[model samples]
Structures are given as C-alpha cells and as structure tokens.
Target: MKAVVYEGPNVLTYKDVADVSPKANEVKLKVRACGICGSDVHGYLGITGRRIPPVIMGHEFSGEIVELGEGVNNLKPGDRVAAYPLDFCGSCEMCAKGDVHLCLNKRAFGVLDVDGAFAEYICVPAKVCFKLKDSVSYKVGSIMEPLAVSYRAVSHAGNLTGKNVLVVGTGTIGLLALSCVKAQNPRRIFVSDLSDSRLEIAKKMGADTVINPSKENSLDVIMDNTNNKGVDAVIEAVGVSATVKQSIDSLAFGGTAVWIGISDKHIDLEMQKIVTRELNVKGTFLYGFEEFRTVVEMLNEGKLNIDPILSKEITLEELPETMAQMAAGAGDIIKVTVVNND
Candidate 1:
C-alpha cells in the first residue's frame, strides 16, 4: 500500500508501506475521500505535538468496505460508509451514558499516535462505521466529522429561534456552525473573520452580516447590528484569547456561548463579565457517536447544505504539498479533501 507518510516535521513522503488488515470486529475500507483538517496542518508544522512522526494523519473520510473481520454481520463488502473516527471503549461509564466522546479510553484517529485514513486502505471498528446513502457523494460523506463537530456546538447553544446569533470565525467549522444555526431560523446571524473571501462565503451560507474584525471592532459591529442589546447566542470557533473574549463580550445577558476551537491550549478569560452577566459558557470538543450519526442523516436527508463547504479536491499523491501550502497561509482554502481516483 502506498501512503503519504509523515517522516518528520514539515516532511511527508509518498512511499510503499505494509498493507493493513481488519482485526476482529473491524472492517477494512478502501478510502474514497478524506478531508484535511486544521489540526492536521498544525501537526504538520510541528506546532502541535499530537501528530508524531511516521503516522498517517487524516480523520474526516468516507470509503467502501472491502472486507469485514470475523464477528461482523451488520454490514457487507462494497457498502459505502463514513466513520465516526473515535474508537471508544463501548462499556465505559461515559459510553453507557451516550457520551462516547468523553469515554475514559478513547483513541481518535489522526490525533496523537493512532494512524488515520491517509492511505489507500484502513481498518476501523465496525461499530463506528455509518452506512451512507447512494445520494451522498464520498466527498460529502468525508466531511461528516467536522459537520458533526459544528452540529454539537450548535446543540450546546440551546434554541436559536428568533434570536440574534454571532459566529466568531468564518473557518470551516464556523461556517458549518452558522448553517446549523440558520436551520433553527435565527432572527439574524453575524459572522466575523479576517478574510473577506470567507466572509463572502459565509454570507451565501446564510449569515445575515459579515464582520472583518481587522477592519472594525467585532464587538462594536455586533452590538450596533443588534441594536446595543448584543446577540442572544455566540459560537466561538476561534480558540484564541481575543476571539474568546469577543464571543463572551458580544453576548446579551443570560446568553450562551459555546467554544469549539482548539488553536490555543490556554488563554485568559474575562471572569467578571461572565459572572456578572450570568452568561452560560460551554467548551465543546469532538462530537459524540450519536452526533456523528445525526450529521450523516442531516446530509442524507438534504437538510444540511455542505456543497459550499469544500474548497478544493486533490488526489492522495498531492496531499503532502497541499498541506504544506495550507501551512504557508492559504486564506482562500476552506476545506481541502483528498480523493482516491483508483
């Protein structure tokens, strides 16, 4: 099997590697499409210590099952599927309570040491595979992971009906979260980003207003647009001190703010503002198993529009260089997905 292996920091090589087979209760999949995430870029640059050398780094993916290990009966060969990517111990207390993402023993693909779907073929637990409809393209199926992340963030925001909402970033997750908020029929949706191109895309994806924080103060713009009352809810998709502060400051009294970005490990918070305003602050990581399944259904049922989400499609051989370009600051690229033509 040929894979783009991460040999070291800022280095990836396309070479032949040993083939992988399905373990018991697992399924071997011929990967069709895999989306490059921001985390992968960070790992490539050696900024994040998660992606160590010699590991394949791709998690958002969809494929066709080529072989099933023993004890697997719910699916068969040739079935198209998208995976949850988080291999969790199903008998844990967190798993029993439907919080698989919080499972005590969990290994997320493409993070830390677990090898992901950046190769021709990979194997995953049969339980994490979700069958995809014929109508859903492999490209769309590949993005279910991030979509699930956005969906979970929106779910944390509670109800958005007729309420003014603000999304503090126009990145892929922010845009997807804006779309999820739109589905609830919010009174208005404001998106903030430094890039005008991403802001334009956000507008088409149902944002009522776009704010370039570099040009104008986002808090002032959000406040002025909402008639000085501030937004009812905010989804902070940029995990930085400034944006996290902006999200907290741009919310109305009793408003909810959900933080999903992991750009920074630690940042100072406005403790007085949150405490005085009685604001609800929640930090969300990855999506639970059910959220991943629901995102697939949302795309399958045509309730979610992911067509505007993907920015580029490349072959597996092109992933390394593409990732390098992305690290060098390609603001126009939102989501780059790798496809297997073979």
Candidate 2:
C-alpha cells in the first residue's frame, strides 16, 4: 500500500508501506477520498503536537470496505462508508452516556494514537463506520467529519432562528459553520476573514455580509448591521488570541459564543465584562456520535452545500508537496482532498 507518511516537521514521504489488516470487529477499507484539514497543515509544521511523526495523517475520509474482520456484524465487504475517527472505551462513563468524544480512553485516527487513512487502505473499528447513500459522492463523504464539527458548534449555540450570527474566519470550518447557522433561518450572518478569496466564497455560500478585517473594521460592520447591538451568537473558527478576543467582543448580551478552533495561546479575557454581560462562552472540540450520524444524514439528503468549500483535489503522490504548500500558506485554497485513482 502507498501512503503519505509524516516523517517530521515540514516533511512527508510518499512511499509503499505495509498493508493494514483489520482486527477482530474491525473493517479494512480501500480509501477513495481523504480531505486535508487545517490541523494536518499545523501538524506538518510542528505547530500542533497532535500529528506525531512516522504516522499516516488523515481522518476526514471515505472508502469502500474491502474486507471485514471476524465478529464484525451488520456490515460487509463492498460497503461504501465514512468513519467516525474517534475510538473510545465503551465501558467508560462518558462513553456509557454516549459522549464518546469525552471518553477518558479515546484514540483519534490521524491524531493521538491511531494510524489513519492517508494510504490506499486502512482499518477502523466496524462500529465507527457509517454507510453512505449512493447520492453522496466520495468527495463529499470525506468532508463529513468537519461538517459534523460545524454542526456540533452550531448546536451549542442553541436556537438561531431569526437571530444575528457572526462567524470568525472564512476557512473550511468557518464556512461550514456559516452553512449550519444559515439552515436555522438566521436573520443575518456575518463572516470575517483576512482572505478576500474565502470571503467571496462565503458570500457565494449565502453569507449576508462578508468583512475583510484587513481592509475594514469587522466589529464596526457587525455592529452597524445589527443596529449597534452585537450579534446574538458567534462561532470562533480561528484558534488565535485575536480571533478569540473578537469572538468574545462581538457577542450580544446573554448571547452564546462557541469556540471550535484549537490553539495553545492564551488570551486575556475580561471576566468582569463576562459577568456583567451574562455571556455564554463555550468550547467545543469534536462531534459526538449523534452529531456525526446527523451530518451523514444531512449529506445523504443533500441538505448541506459543500461544493464551494472544496478547493482542490490531488493524488496521493501529490500530497507531500501539497502539505508543504499549505503549511507555507501558498495559495487561497480552502480545502484540498487527496483522491485514490488507482
């Protein structure tokens, strides 16, 4: 099997590797499409410690089950599926409550402890795999993970019907968050980003207003649009001090702010203001099992528009160079997917 192996910081090697065999109660899948996430770029740059070297780094993927391990039930070979990357201990308290993402013993594919789908084939727990409808393309199936993350963040924001919402950053997650917020029939959606290309894409994707903070003031634009009152909800997709601050400052009184981005930097927060304004600030990591299943259903029903968010598609051989380019911020690309054409 050929895979894009992460050797070290800013290093990726495309070479043949040992084929993976499914364990008991697992399935071996021939990968069809795997999307490159922002976290992957960060891992390549050694910014995030999530992607350790000597591992295949991809979790947002879709593939066909070529083989099933002994004891695997309800699914068989030739099934088209997308998998939830997190594997948790079923006996844990969090898992018992169906909050698997919070399980104390959790191993995330392409991240913490598991090898992932950056190759021709990979094995995953049969329980994590969900069958995809014929109407959902493999390209779209690869995006279910991030879409699930966006859905979870929006769900944290509670009811958005006829409320103003602000999404910070126009990256793939932010764009997907925008789409999820729109589905709730929000009165207006404001998107902020430094990239004009991404902002344009957000506009095309139904953002009520797009603000390039580099040129214009995003806070002013948001305030003016909402008649001087801040937005009712904010989704912070950029995990930076500035963006985190912006998310907190852009919320209305008693409004909700959900932080989905991951960053090590700490920001100074006005605890007094938070208390006075009665703001609801929450941090969301990954999606739970229910959110993951809901995202797959939404994709199958064609309720989410993911076409504009896909920027490029490349082969496995092109993955190393593409990761380097993404780490260097070379292009205005939003999302890149690696397809196995073999």
Task: Score each candidate by Cα lDDT.
Answer: 0.91, 0.89
Q: Tell me the deviation in Å of residue 148 in model 2.
A: 1.8
Over all chains combined, what TM-score does candidate 2 have? 0.92
Q: Superposing every Cα of model 1 onto the true structure, what RMSD results?
A: 1.9
lDDT of 2 by residue, 1-342 (tens): 899999888889999999899999999999999999888888888877887788899999999999999999889888999989888889999989989988999888899446888999999999999999989888889998999989999999999999999999887889999888887889999999998988899988889999988899888999999988899999999888888888888888998999987764677677876789999999987788889999999888777777899889999999999888888785788889999866
Question: Which ten contiguous residues of candidate 2 have the minimum total lDDT?
Answer: 261-270
Best by lDDT: 1
Q: Per-residue lDDT of 2-113 in model 1, one digit per residue for the tens?
A: 7888878999888788999999999999999999998899899988799988899899999999999999999999999999988999899998998989889999888888
Backbone clashes counted, model 1: 0
- TM-score per candidate, chains pooled: 0.93, 0.92
Q: Which residue runs does candidate 1 get wrong by more than 4 Å?
A: 217-220, 265-269
